[model samples]
Every structure is written in structure tokens, then in C-alpha cells.
Target: MAPRPNIIRIGMLVYPGCLRSGAVMPFDVFHIANTLSGLRVAANRVHFDTCWLSARKEKTLTVGGLSFHPQPADLEALDALMLPGIDHQGPYDLSPLLLGLGPEQEMLRRYAQTGKPIISSCSSTCLVAEAGLLDGRRATTSWWLAAYFRKRFPAVTLDAEQLVVEDGNHVSSGGVTSYLDLALWLVGRFGGDALRQSTAKVLAMDANRSSQAPYIAAAMIQDEGHAVIERARRWLNQRLDRTWNMAELAAHCHTSPRTLLRRFQDAAGMSPTQYAQQLRVERAKALLESTKLSLEDITGRCGYEDVSTFSKVFKRWARITPREYRARFGLRQ
Candidate 1:
């Protein structure tokens, strides 16, 4: 393939039922990137031109009960395309809605054949899955719909905890609000990383989110067999400083080790060890935010004997070094 030009042309899928903000945010972010790029030198500048596109030829389009003027799509002319979330009512079957988008699915299939990126988040991720774009691919969707998404699209590797997932050209972000994450990522991809950071600062957006773990409420994870997982989590939290033992965790949770592993993995999307590590990281974040503790002190408090290992794990979960996290979000003395 030839080199892509500095001017990125992106297309957004527009339809009546999609969320308004989902359609609007990428435009807003790219608009900001374009504005900020003007202040940069020629070599550092990157620009964007975007279009609101629909499968049908419509004079005026209604999206999420609001109005939009959209062009009939020309996928070949664009560098990439984005899909906005359809209004999905949760814990319910979506076959009817997915089947109804015949024209849109065909459009997506045609576009996929070109190997250009098709980015989506929230409920519209189901649309991409239904269209067969996500098969054998790792993707994510709104966490509430994760069970249904896994059942419906078993071929796709669904990691619901991550805020954004970039597998090849198809980037999937989590939830409706994560469009900001996706948009900033696109800015960095086409406009360069510095431009992305500058645009994020102007927009007052934290563009470095690595996971959706911080935002997922504990209550949301307590469904079905999750009570056992919760019990195991509590046990792990209390014993963070001690070496982890699956047998002991299972005994305390009143289940066999096999059952505990299966249930915890099913409920939490991670193994018990991973969960233990995450719990330790969360505790470390609190200490970092509230106290002027040294890294060594925080490391021991969060179950790691060494600051180096603690720092590595903290960065993996938080997407920044503990010191950086503290510098940005820590309370001043």
C-alpha cells in the first residue's frame, strides 16, 4: 500500500437510531485536532476531513431523535470509517435490531473488503459483529451487554474491561462515553501523538485511559454466581500482603478450587491472581492519591515486596507510572 497522506478523511455511520453524541464526538475531536494543528509547524501538522454518511440517500436524517444532514457513503474515498452506537436496551435479545440493519451490514461488508478500518463502540459493536466483521477478532462493547455479546459473537475475543482495543485496523472502544478515547486515538494515529495530547488538553480530556476497570461498579459484577467471586475478592483484599493461595481462597469462599477458578474467571473476566493484582493496584492508587508515601512503602502496602515490580504492575493497570499517576491526581500536602 502507498503511504497515507497527512490529511485523514474519516467517514461516520449515520442512521436514525444511533446516539447523537456518538456521531458528534469524533467530529468534535477531529475539529479540535484540525484547529490545534494550525498552530504547529508544517512537518508536525496533521489534519482531518470527515463526512456523515448513510447507506440510504436521504435529504435530512434523524439520528437519536435529532436531525443530521448526511451524504450517501463513498467508502473508497475515505481513509477510515466509524460506527456510532444504536440505542440498545440491555439484558434483552438484539436479534431483531441486528437483522433490521440489512443495508448497513452490506455497506460494512463491502467496506471491510477494502481493508480500511471500521471503528465502533457500545451497541453498534453488535452491529459490526452481526455483519461478520468481528469474527476471529478481539473486540469490546458496553460492559453491561458483555454476556450477550459473548454468547452472540463467540468467535470474537471480547475483553470488556479495556477502555479501547486496537486489533489490526479495527479499533473497538468500550461504552458510549469512550468515543473520546477512540477519537483521541485516531488523532494520534493520523495527526501525530503530540497533536493528540494538545487536543486532549484543550478539550480537558484524559486521553490515556487503558482500561474500563476503574469505572465498572462493584455491584455490576455481583450478578448470578458473583457473590462467591465477591467473597473471594474480599478474602484476597484482606490478605494482599501474603502470598496468594487458590486453595485457601476457595476454602474461604466455601467452594472447591476448580469451581472457584471457573466462577471467578466467568464473573470477573480474569483469573484470581489477576484480580488480586488489580485489587492491590487499586489500593496503591488510593495511597498514592492520599499520602506522600514513598514508592517502597506503597509497594509493600499493595502486596509487592519490591518497588520495581509494583511500579510495573501499577503502570500496566493505570497506563502510567505510579509517580505520574500521583503527580496528576494526587492531593497536595
Candidate 2:
């Protein structure tokens, strides 16, 4: 068994326009874990000592109407550092906002040199990457930002399919809501898996969920476009209800299979076949959410004749069965 600290003091960095949930939820989870510790008879139960911190922006840091007067940039006192998601309206607003995070970036660099734990979730991973902390490190961000992160931080190996990634003392997780996963992970890491389970049961979260694959969406499918790839995408969308081959798709786009493959690999970061699979998964998610169709019917509609095969394909991307997805996210009528 690893040596468990009696109390783990984590400092969550809060910046301007940061996602309030990212800051709030982790605190709530840690607080809840402390409450759960009261119920345990085990000796030396780990305690989480968490506080919100910033680079002293204001007497009170107010973002999205919530206010917090965080602690100072005292890196020596912290056992670990956490960064929560900052709000952004997709790709358009993302870059402009990052340009202003210079102070925050320097903070990461200073703390990173200490070689203690530094955790960043969602768009905060970009700040860490910008600070050059994630270079040659395995990290992840929101799956939608996979292409952008790769192009921007080529030195850092991006694995956007994971809910959380820990390389050395640096820990990173995906997207905005993954703070929940990050918080739960910290609980399990510093405390114990048994406590993590009891806390998760009380919190009503799926403790075993690890991969971000099932939540993958096609929103970023058109990010870096090639003319041939765009044409292929349009053609595929039109016939997603039918199976397709690369040769047929290339012909429709007036390109050879080899040309299409080259251009697609360059533009989409995956094969045309993989992109088509994403489209199918996205389509299946939509149908599952909005329609009450049977599994067999939905399978045929998504171009799979076999329901089992369709389930496998869907699970490959969405991480859950179509029925399970519908049960959780489907419309109630």
C-alpha cells in the first residue's frame, strides 16, 4: 500500500470567466468525501484540505455571478494544484481568451517546476500545454478539441479518449464536466478505492467509468477542412443510411482512393472510415435521444443490418449501448 497522507491540501486555481461548476463541483466532492470519512472506522483515513486560489486578481473573484476570495500563489504550502475549466463559446472564442491567460500560464510553469502534482481539466489543459508543461507528456482535453490541441501542441501526446491522464506528477483530464471524474480520482488516489466507492455511491456517479470514447461526438469533424475531404464528408452524410467503401466515396468526391486517403489523413487526423463511423455514432445518438425506434430499426437506419454489430460500433464511439444511452439521455414522453 502506498503511503497515504493524513491530509491532502489541493489548491484549485480560479481565473476570470472560469467555469463555475469546475471550481464548485470538485470542492463539493471533496467536502462530501470528508463527510463520508466520518462514517469509516478505518484508522488514518485521509482528509482533503481544499481551497480556491488565484494570482490576486481582486479582493473577491467573481465569475459568472459567483464570488470567491481565493488564496494567494503560495506554491510551497500546497500538496497539489488543480485547474478548472474556463468558459468558452467553442472554437471561435477559445484562442482569444487564451491569449489573456499569461499570468495563469506563468503560475503553472512555476508550480510545475516544483515537481508536485498539478491537475488541469477541460480548457485548462490548454494553459498547461501553453506553459510547456505537457510537452512530451500524455494528456487529454475535451474530445472536440483533439484536432486543435494536436496542431497547437505537437510536442505533447494528446489522448483525448481518456477521462483522466496522469504522467509523472502532472495529472490532466478531459472537458468541463470531467472535473467530477478528476475529483473522484483524487479521492481514490490519496485516500483509498474503498472510500472512493462509498463516496461515489452517495454521489450517484458511475465510479467505474474511465474512458471518454463513448462521449465522442462529430462536432469537430469539419475543423481542418480539405476540399476533397469536405466533398467526401458531404457525400457520406447524404448516405449514412447505407454502407460505403473508400473507393465509392472517393469517386463521388472526384478523387482517387489514394488521394482521398492522403488528404483525409492530413485533414481529419483519422481515416475516412473512422470519420464515417463517428458520423454513424452521432446519428445513432440523435435517433436514440429523439426517437422511440426499436434497436433493430435504429440499426438498419444507421446502415447496420445487424443490431449486435450496430451496438458494437456505437459502443466503440459512445461507450455505452444504444439502449443504455437512450435510457439515460433519451426524451421522456
Candidate 3:
């Protein structure tokens, strides 16, 4: 028999006042990855050892109304360390849990110096940024803290719209949902595309699917012609479950279908139908992630009368089959 592949051990640092949502999000993704991959791969081929490295020895600490216990393990054993955001009124007001420069800090710093992968979500970026690990690297955090992050960490380049930014060994993401993106990206990196897709299907999430740049760039044109396109987007968002007609939409916007087509193409770089299809696909993806609805139900909800059509559109938009997508991102049935 062949030797087993080296297992990847991930350490999750749980400190007091940490955001429960952020911490739980990555844990859920990795947990699902382990379950799905472990069935096929040998126990030794793929395994996840999650340890809670905390400064204190308390069995339970309340964070966001939930209690958590720390694991007994040194940080040197982890291949990756995850830092979930904590609630702080300001950057200067550090969490009491992280006040001292003890073994936890030293271990993290050593991992950083050795080029080990570290992922931080939301305000957790501030912790690594303070350690000077993100200097001259591109990163992001919650959009609300973009200005503050930029002001405080002048050495790091801030990209506010990105779901996550990867700079060498350091990676950071914006807001809570971006944690899913980061976890999916990590899954793809460590477990291969099959495992990543399987995890995404379980969560019903679209991994790295859409590019917001085109939408933002078109919105920035700021002309009367662009107003019509903006109105169409708003209109589609509101009527995502209903079938859309170009002539009717044009009439509602007080323009001919030809004029509507011309303006929308110039502004959004896509036809109105194309844009509407994208919205429908996105809606389907959300339903897959947030609900226990069946694929046919999701297809109908996204305005696809035919299941085949919906599956094709979903695959085109997400680069994975709907069933595979759901399996990778959806909750276990």
C-alpha cells in the first residue's frame, strides 16, 4: 500500500468577545469538507484537527451569547490559524483576552515569519495588521471599517469590495459572508476542486462566481442613460421571481425596447435578458444556501419554468451543476 498523504491541521483561535458568526462560519465549512472528503480518502489521507488556542484556561467563555471551551494544544502543530473578528468600539480598545504578549501571540508571530497560511475575517484583520504581518500586502475587512483600517494600517493596500484578499501566506476577508468565500477558497486550495465543489453544494453557495466590478463600473457612468439601466436592475431585483419582458420593462421605463437595449448594453455591457438571467441564477443560489428547498422548487422560485433550463443557467453562471453546487454548499439533508 502507498503511504498516506500528510494531513492538514487547522487551528482556530477563540478569544473572548469573538464574533460567533465569523468563528462558526469557517468551522462549519471545514467540518463539512472533512466529512465529505474523509469518506473517500483514507483517514490518514485527509484529516482536520481543530484546536482552540486561547490564553486563558477557562472551560467556557461567553462570546456573542455563546459559550466555548479552549483546546489544549500548542499552536506550532497547526498548518493554518483562523482569527475570527471580535467586537471593539475602536482599534485602541483591545480585547482583554488579547492584552498580553504570551505564548499564543508568540506562536502566531512565529507562524507568520515562517510563511504559514493565516486567515482573518472581519475585524480580525486588525489583529494581524497590528502585528505588521500585512505590511505592503493587499487585504480587506468589513466595509464599514475600510477607512479606519486604511488609516491605521497605512502599509497595507485596502480593497473594500473584494470578498477576500490573498497576499502570500496572509489572507483576509470582508464582513461575515466573505468568510464562506475564504473557507471555500481554502477548501479548493487544500482539498482539490471536487471537495470544494462538494462543500459548496452542501452550503448552496456560489464560490467565486460573479464579478462586481462590471456592475460598479457601469453604475459609476452617472448619466441619464445610465439611470434607465439602474432602474432596470432595481426592477429586476424586485421581480426576481416573475418572468420579465423587454417591451414591458421598456414601456415602464418610458422608452422603446430598442432604446432600452441600446442604453443597457452601453451601461452594463450586457443585454437586459442576460442581466436578468444572472439575477435569477443568483437568486437560485441564495435559495440553495439559505433554505431546504428542492432543486425544482428553487428553479421555479428563480422563474425557471423548466428544470433543465434552470440547471443550464445555474451551471453557466456558477461553473458547477446545480446538484453539485447544492451538495457542496447546502446543509446535510
**Best model per TM-score:** 2
Candidate of highest lDDT? 2
Model 1 lDDT-worst window of ten: 216-225
Off by over 4 Å in 1: 1-6, 221-333
Question: lDDT of each structure?
Answer: 0.82, 0.85, 0.73
Q: Counting only residues 3 or more apart in sequence or on different chains, how many pairs clash (N, Cα, C under 3 Å) in candidate 3?
A: 18
The local distance difference test score of model 3 is 0.73
Which residue pairs show backbone clashes in model 2? 214-318, 214-319
Model 2 C-alpha lDDT per residue in residues 1-333, reported as the tens digit of each score = 544548889899998978999988999999899988766765647789999889756779999889998877789888889998869877546777888988888888888888899989998898888888888889989888887778788999988888899999988898788898889888998878988898899899998877877677775635654578777778888888987787898889888898888887877778998888889888899899998998888888888889999898898788788888999889998
TM-score, cand. 3: 0.58
Winner on TM-score (1 vs 2): 2
2 versus 3: better TM-score goes to = 2
- The count of residue-pair clashes in candidate 1 stands at 0
Error of 2 at 225 (Å): 4.9
Task: List the candidates ranked by lDDT, beginning with the highest.
Answer: 2, 1, 3
lDDT of 2: 0.85
